[model samples]
Target: MKFDLTEERQMLQDSLRRFLGDRYTTARRNEIIDSETGMSAEIWSQLAELGVIGAMFTEDQGGFGGAGFDIAVVFEELGRAGVVEPFLDSALIGGRLLAEAGQGEKVEKVMEGALHLALAHGEPGSRYDLNHVETTARDGVLTGRKAVVMNAETADLMIVSARVSGDVADQDGIALYLVDKGTDGLTIQGYPLLAGGRAAEVTLDHVRGTELFGADKGYQALADVTALATVAQCAEALGAMETATALTKDYLMTRRQFGRPIGTFQALAFRMSDLLIEMEQARSAVINAAGYFDTDQRDLYVSGTKNLMGRAGRLVAEEAIQLHGGIAMTQEYELAHIAKRIVMADHRFGDTDYHLERFIDLSAA
Candidate 1:
């Protein structure tokens, strides 16, 4: 019956909010987004020192928290501040994958923000399918390109997936390797993302890598880590939606029309009410997904959550823009950045259509 966050989680949320509020102004976030790296090393270090990175992992993994709620809590704050840092890449995905590979020291460096990690799994045309790894490994070298390898440009290490045994799409043939940043035959074409952050098109030509897991264990680990990523993303979208609605509300309340606040109009009031309802529903889905965590039932909840949240996020973004007009689209404002983040979240991990099909498939099973 208790739907509230645990006391520790609440405290973590408060601390993150306070820190970001004090230091991460809208202008500062915009500057980071505009930077070549699309992130800030100094800010990243501050967050790590505040225990933000460590909060995303379990105690057994040398972190104080690793529950699904823990991830949701941390990511929600990140999104609220429009943080473009690689916390999701470093902690929820990479840190956990390192733990799975028994690379505890690397994980420690990650928690300390001394290292960054990216998972180079999705290849060209992969389109959010975790099993569609076309990159190949042979004779101790990896070849092929990884698409949208988030944070790979800055990552000291990458967890690359390659097919070692069967067809590219075969679930059983995928393996994972740890490739160092400066490895021979490894190349990255880094680019800033639309919503903020850096990703790369990583090319490997017989690149040497330390084997992390063979096909036997690789697929399951990749799947689990991806599911965790999906959960974190959905929580982030919820935070972005919160910002969008708040911004829209402020605009409506303050922007006078015909000598009256536009928010006083019944039609606008009804629409704002509808947006709030949708947001609450999205929040419910996030809570449900977080509760399932990484268990067998996790896929079901995550799929449902991602599907619903994606749709709701799009609606929130579009509606907020309509209410706020052209100003909402300008980069000078916080809502513009927040709205973009909300809308783009649907495209990552899996989109609404993908997760809806996945949810139905799981339900039938």
Candidate 2:
């Protein structure tokens, strides 16, 4: 249980931190978020060139490191920097979905940052269930609306889920289709997420898409890919918690209250200690999930880790803002965005409630 990065992973971590630290500053991030795609094309290209995207996959998928720890390493850095990039969607989730569907060349392009992909799985009222697809695909044509698909606007291609047969909630009837951007009968209405990304409400009216995966196999692949994305997101939240805690600690020491720094107050000091402990616990959960990511125990660990991270993220967000008082609420300050991102991260994939139930069910089984 000595959860330390290997020599190569350490190098990768060091390089990513340095690169993001230098370029993705608060001001620059704001610019990117306000951009049309909610991401920076220049930064995306640079990251791909630096092999940051490639590091998340295996050699067969055209990446050097596709381990669970590799995913944790990459996303933790992304969280630390508060980057708004679509790496999570395009590179991690969509890229792997393509590969799992036997589309290696597309994954290669995704790793290269030349192509972007979105997984259009969640539909209206799906509420995080992988098999709750109501969209239909017949004769290679799709019909139905997908709600809140991440990175949809930037994706050159999207893997949409549909039901070719059986009832909507039945797990066996699920299928996946590959739809290109600007395809006929495909309409996307995208908006910024509360965190730092873009999502779209997609409507397909008899749109034809290539079948990447069919009934009986699509659900499991979606589950596995979503599980991996969950791990990456939890790691990202851990990184954000680290940044928020550090910012609070620094503020405590420097900000004056009465005759001395507010950190001297015993009550404030205790709260800060609690925040640190919660953060460490969150880190442990992320490490555990990432370690078990490729194993049979992935579901158990992922659910438990996500549930912990969600609660911990809320705690850190609230405590950090309270510790900073009025300054933290200001849009110009760093903590404002970080705090928001932490809370919003909880709601993505599954929130605290969803993961807690998932953990209970999986444990019983």
Candidate 3:
């Protein structure tokens, strides 16, 4: 299958790369991550103005491109820059969920960057199970805890998952609610993550929420959204791996020992070659996942892609750091952040082991 992007997507990629290259320097990203919100409002607004957020949705949802490839393209660029923006949370996952629930106005607000959203789905000990929701919603009130909610601290709105009926791990009777920030009985404990981002521990006790797309029905949508996020993360890891490999190559060529560049040694050169091979395989997996998204077998492909990316990302990050010596471990260098992001991307949505198990389960079915 042809993986070439259309003209529109190509232009979008070029424009976004140029913009990020000009503005999103390592120092600037550090400042953003160190800020109170752990993000740059100005950069978010600029992304919106460039139609970056809008591109993640379909035309029906007021976006020009909403295909899996669109999401992959945007996220890959973001990953290459090591950007800390919340596009995956706000636009790809939360906005798409609202759009699927027929909340067009809310999606539009999110596309405009006037609203920020977090999905409060993961719970303590949920362990990558989308259906393992201990949070309960009854009588339009939510009561329970959500752990490690990304962007919840600064989000203007939150999409929460709760069980309205049935057991905690049952797929049926899973529901979603729309809760505004600062609501009574809603508490958010914000903290920084080791991966250079922020997350919150959200607790709700008798906090009222408006049902999204009716009550006690959203498990399928949640599953689909999670798969989409997983695919986007695969793309992001591919980008980071690409950067890491290139940096390692450059370092080997310039850094010399015994009156010769280290790259001249067969051992180091062979390792670099192996890294390139892994990167290529990871790229192919990402492309396959993007193509399969929106199809009946999307979940299967997503799981496979994420598993491959996780392995590839870990290999690339470790080798890049080792090959570059101690300099790659320091925060002052760009490769250090890129490598860290690549490694951490594997843990989101689901880790390598999680996706491998899921892939086997889906294949058996």
Q: lDDT of each prediction vs. the true structure?
A: 0.90, 0.90, 0.89
Q: Write the per-residue lDDT of candidate 3 for residues 3-82, one digit (tens) a residue.
A: 68999999988999999989998888888888888889999999999988988999988889989999989888888888
Task: Please say which candidate is ahead in lDDT: 2 or 3.
Answer: 2
Please list all clashing residue pairs in model 1, or write none if there are none. Answer: 57-65
Candidate 3 local Cα displacement, residue 248, angstroms: 1.0
How much is the lDDT of residue 245 in candidate 3?
Answer: 92
lDDT by residue for model 2 over 181-237, one digit each (tens)? 899999999999876679999999999999999888889988888889999999888
Task: Give the poorly placed runs of model 2, Cα more than 4 Å off.
Answer: none
TM-score of candidate 2 on Cα atoms, chains taken together? 0.98
Order the candidate numbers by lDDT, best to worst: 1, 2, 3
TM-score of 1: 0.98
